[model samples]
Target: MKLTALKTMAATVALGVSMAGAAFAADLRIAYTGYSTDNTFWIGVAKAAAARADEMGVELLDLTASSPDAAAQKDAVDRAINMGVDGIIIGSVDNRAFDASLDSAKRKGIPVVAVDTGIEHDHVSSLVQTDNLAAATIAGGYIVDQLDAGTVLILGGSAGHQTGNARRDGVKNAAEAAGHEVIFQICDWQDACAYETTVNFLQSNPDIKAIFSAWDPGALAAVSAASELGKLEDLVIVGFDGNPANLVSIEAGEQAATIKQDNTRMGAEAVSNLIGLIKGESVPAFTPIDGILITSDNVAEFK
Candidate 1:
């Protein structure tokens, strides 16, 4: 009887140890960085990614920069590397500035995946982003189709940011393809800056018929500028990112349209790619998420 009792206790203890080992073995840490949580679009992406990480039994540590400063972002990446995370995901302010840091992460045996924006270096294991250029082209085409005969103004983001440049090029290409002339200006992605630039542009060119902004805030700025000038009806404003605020503008007829990027899908795909890399599975280096053009006609669908 004593032998039986001893055998049962030994078996129980062994099972307990095995379960603990499995629990410890299942832990994975991922570091994520992006622009800021102040924007609803980014907040939604972060929340969905966190939920996905929970579902996958992995731990995600979010590291955000105060602003869109590359130096601060690089610091966040370095901190993540020092923490020895299994993988790191970044939406870089500048694609080329992080090459050395990415190389360092690769040397540390950590896979790096870029989300929403890309890195120029080959050290990044994968990239998951929306087709920004195509989306911009769609926005431009929408604007051109809406207005009959008037000038369209382009409000762009920072000069060096690759995403901003791609968006600008797309809008320009599409507008030219449609045989419409575009008056373009760079706003550094700040709402105040965009507002000021838009107001100035409107003052100088009151006949501006449409405005296409590369981001939601910039679009809102254009809307505000137009409303203040009592030209909201004459101006058709379009934006990217399909933010909740922009949706309100669309519903109110203050803004014409926006391009919706599936950021949740972006986050989930990035995590999946990282897992594949961890498992030694071959994964595509670049993954492009398609965008949907949202206008008042189909804004309900997006909501």
Candidate 2:
């Protein structure tokens, strides 16, 4: 009986040591899947979030879709699940394409926080993004004031994506309500695609008075296309996401304006929310970061 007690005490000490080692080594392992790093906006996000993760002493697993590819994003989710992540924070490629993977994570009791886009699943515990509808409304209102009922070329992201669709609908709805016709040219938010599409559309509709891209890169592409045609001065070109490149264009009188999203803050806040969730704290269902309009009048401020 003394030998049995001794053996039991040894086993208990071993278990306690093992548990303490695990607690000391890895408090949590969280994963983050971002949008295309090709966009400088997302790059800013990644850098800021990584800094926050480091400060929190948490291991951040970074995964990003190259450029709004659902398959790639889904693969990333699978990898995160397979890694047994404590939680996942994702800026979904399409927001609607991760149903299966998210469902799998849910079954495994892994929580998810969405950033920059809304996934239509109850599994997502929190969402952090700009007020896209309000931002796009501002864009539309600006366009309405700048042009007098001329067709506005709506160059932007994939129409199926929630953030893309929200921006599109917000602008389209507002622009249409003001008696302006909107023709959507979805380009998956690719700069080259925006350039080519703008060139073709302008060739066919030289009367187009304004161009509004949902993101700044597309705006930059539109500016280049118009400048190449010696029509930069004639078009009212506006974009979202106040990238420095877009600000430079606005300064150069190529693009007219852009909306600046606080992407860095959004990224940091996502990490904060994830950490809070892990600590058994209730997080808000939605978190919003502010955005601003960057034109020649205020571009210098952002710069």
Candidate 3:
């Protein structure tokens, strides 16, 4: 989908809903646990979810983890179930770590909606997230087409993570198919680690001509590393998660492009779907939101 259309849809979802006579919304309490509180992406999701919950007259508990701790996330879910919330929304740090907690919620008849990260559980009523593999393929194709020749470095999320693996493979597959050599590194979703790795790797490998980050912060970290090494203008940098800060970098020409996810829509849709489940209504099992690749050429539309 186009960037403009996605923004318009988010606005409509935010401003078009009627506040009066939301009978199903009354007395509804929803609990949401995000991937982490430190990331701007999750912050955006929390903000949108809170706004939508308010519009629908539902009480939302933002129980986002202070850091990327899978244990904390599971505990938060367990707490919400103990509180007897009508529904729950989760952006899990580790999707595989929630079975026990989610099972308890299921026994208590509490509905769940997984967002961003896919949780494989029977209790989850819906999944709302970006098509990460497809979006990363687009970013990789851009790198291959725009750069003449050189190795590409990929800074990815934690190993064995489903979403991270999909993104990593998407870019790796595209670049390798185009005959561009690719190098990979796991940043464990830490900006400091990404920065250090980029610096050390670039110091040893001058043949690297492009960088792809699985998330926005790592992209910014790469930009910083390249700048400090006087190689900022020599490399093409692209990142995932259309973070507002990353867009600023794109506008300044510090970065080339980023795949922007519909975080607002994901948050609102998760809440909406959970409410439907709470009301004994059916909602789609999976909700895939489109991502737009924002570059200096089209960054104005997003801003």
What lDDT is reached at residue 41 by model 1? 73
When sorted by lDDT, best at the front, the candidate numbers are: 3, 2, 1
Query: Per-residue lDDT tens digits of candidate 2, residues 82-122?
Result: 99998899988778788899899999988899999999998
Off by over 4 Å in 1: 1-25
What TM-score number comes out for model 2? 0.89
Q: Residue 275 error for model 1, in Å?
A: 1.7
| Whole-model lDDT per candidate | 0.84, 0.87, 0.91
TM-scores of all predicted structures:
0.90, 0.89, 0.91
Instruction: Report the lDDT tens digits of candidate 3 across residue range 1-303.
Output: 699999999887766564433655878999999988889999999999999999888999999888999888888999999999999999989889988898899899999999997888888889999988888999999999887889999999987887888888989999999999999999888899889989998999999999999999999999999999999999999999999999999999999999999999999999999988998998999999988989999999998
- Candidate 2 has which clashing residue pairs, if any? none
Give the per-residue lDDT of model 1 (tens digit) for 1-303. 999999999999999998874574368888888877677777877777787777777789989765678788898999999999988888777676787788889899998888888777777879889989888888888887887777778888877777888888888887777777788888877899778888898999867788889898899988998889888888888899989889888988889999998989988888878767766789989899998998888888766
Cα deviation of 51, candidate 2, in Å: 1.3
Q: Which portions of model 2 miss their true places by more than 4 Å?
A: 1-26, 65-67
Q: Give the candidate number with the greatest TM-score.
A: 3
Q: What is the alpha-carbon lDDT of model 2 when measured against the actual structure?
A: 0.87
Please give me the total number of clashing residue pairs in predicted model 1: 0
Ordered by TM-score, highest first, the candidates read 3, 1, 2
